[model samples]
Target: MGNNRQTLLLSDSGYDCENKTGEQMLEEAKKNLQSMAFFGLTEYQNYTQKLFLKIFSKNFKLAEEFAQSNRTFAETFINKQNDTVQIPYLEEIKRLNKLDIELYSFAKELFFKRLKDFRIV
Candidate 1:
């Protein structure tokens, strides 16, 4: 006896099959992947913000501003760069508030290290 198998292709809605073509299925897969990636990034960002606040519990506003600025800088500059470079706003924040420079440096290093390790930088 010969083994026979059948594969079923379901539409994105998963209720029925409309006889979609290969290209259509590929496009649907790409859309789903992009959506999943976006969702994961969003969750990661939220977690990072919470972690930052927890680390700098005494200066929530400063931590929030710095996080926001860093996000903007990364999106606008670091993401486009091929070479590793310094983050711009940390020094300004340190000078403005007489913050613990070493602590700030350590936190920044950890953040970038995590990004690099994840290959997101």
Candidate 2:
């Protein structure tokens, strides 16, 4: 008899849903976390929000660097650009947010593999 197992393909993830090595899964988790963190940072309006997201993402260095660069860019843009000018990275942030949501769902499924019948509230 042949093995009857089916492998699910996570949308846009390029990950084989079954038989993933632990390291590969860990790498995927890292990618998801970072993407989500970037989304958070792009939307953050205050220091408290940034700090919370930094903790959630477990990437202090990235958070610090991003914060500094964002501040510098905003200052420069405001000083040089008029209100009619559009910020360049807004579209990139939107794209990342969409991708992050998908990755987050994929990670959730990977996390609850053993409890497939259970629903997260």
Candidate 3:
């Protein structure tokens, strides 16, 4: 089987990317990016949120850095009709950890494998 990269859309009831300004879209994407479901657990979600908030509150620059995740995330969204974008939250974490590309690629593959395994389970 081939690696199919089919992506999904992020649906906002109103004021989404299609109708919103670039700044507004980025703001919304930042907020939406902070979800625990992508981490696959409530604990991970809460912890990451807290850590991000702490950093953001103390140093605004760092918060914006986390928010900058949209750049990589956009690659997936742009291909929503074709390739599947794995969870951006994990990608954000990897970026924050300053892990190299090879490590991140492995992390991505692991996420796909887990997602596949989840379907089987």
Candidate 4:
């Protein structure tokens, strides 16, 4: 099952699969996984404050609970964003925002999917 899925992704992503050894294939797969994970992290870092604000506007208590339980630094980070002229973590955010459309899309989908877990549905 895993090999079938990997084959599909490799073809879809334009990998040249004809002569690659199994170790080579495995290394490529690992790299892809790491890249996707990095995208997801960058997406969360870039947009978590927006998510917090949206939750705050709708359900203040829930938002507070979420921050306290899941993101203890959220309030401080938001305050820094508001009080300073420069955005916090701008470089990290731009890492996703400026490159790799496929990775950006993957990160975006992962970010929005958290809305369900956060009970925003």
The weakest ten consecutive residues by lDDT in model 2 span: 1-10
Q: Write the per-residue lDDT of candidate 1 for residues 17-89, one digit (tens) a residue.
A: 3575434543453444434312222325654554545545565565244233225644666567554343445
Q: Where's the lowest-lDDT run of ten residues in candidate 1?
A: 1-10
What ordering of candidates by lDDT runs from best to worst?
4, 2, 1, 3
Of candidates 3 and 2, the better by lDDT: 2
Candidates 1 and 3 compared by TM-score, better number: 1
lDDT (Cα, 0-100) at 29 in candidate 1: 39
lDDT score for candidate 4 against the true structure: 0.48
Go through the candidates in order and give the C-alpha RMSD of each one to the true structure: 20.6, 13.7, 17.7, 12.9
Give a tens-digit lDDT track for model 4, residues 12-100: 24455567654454455445654542222432543465456564655544324323234546566666664454465655554433323
Full-model lDDT, candidate 2: 0.42
Report the lDDT of model 2 for residue 36.
46
- Considering every candidate listed, which one attains the maximal lDDT? 4
Clashing pairs in 1: none
Clashing pairs in 4: none
**Cα miss at 77, model 1 (Å)?**
48
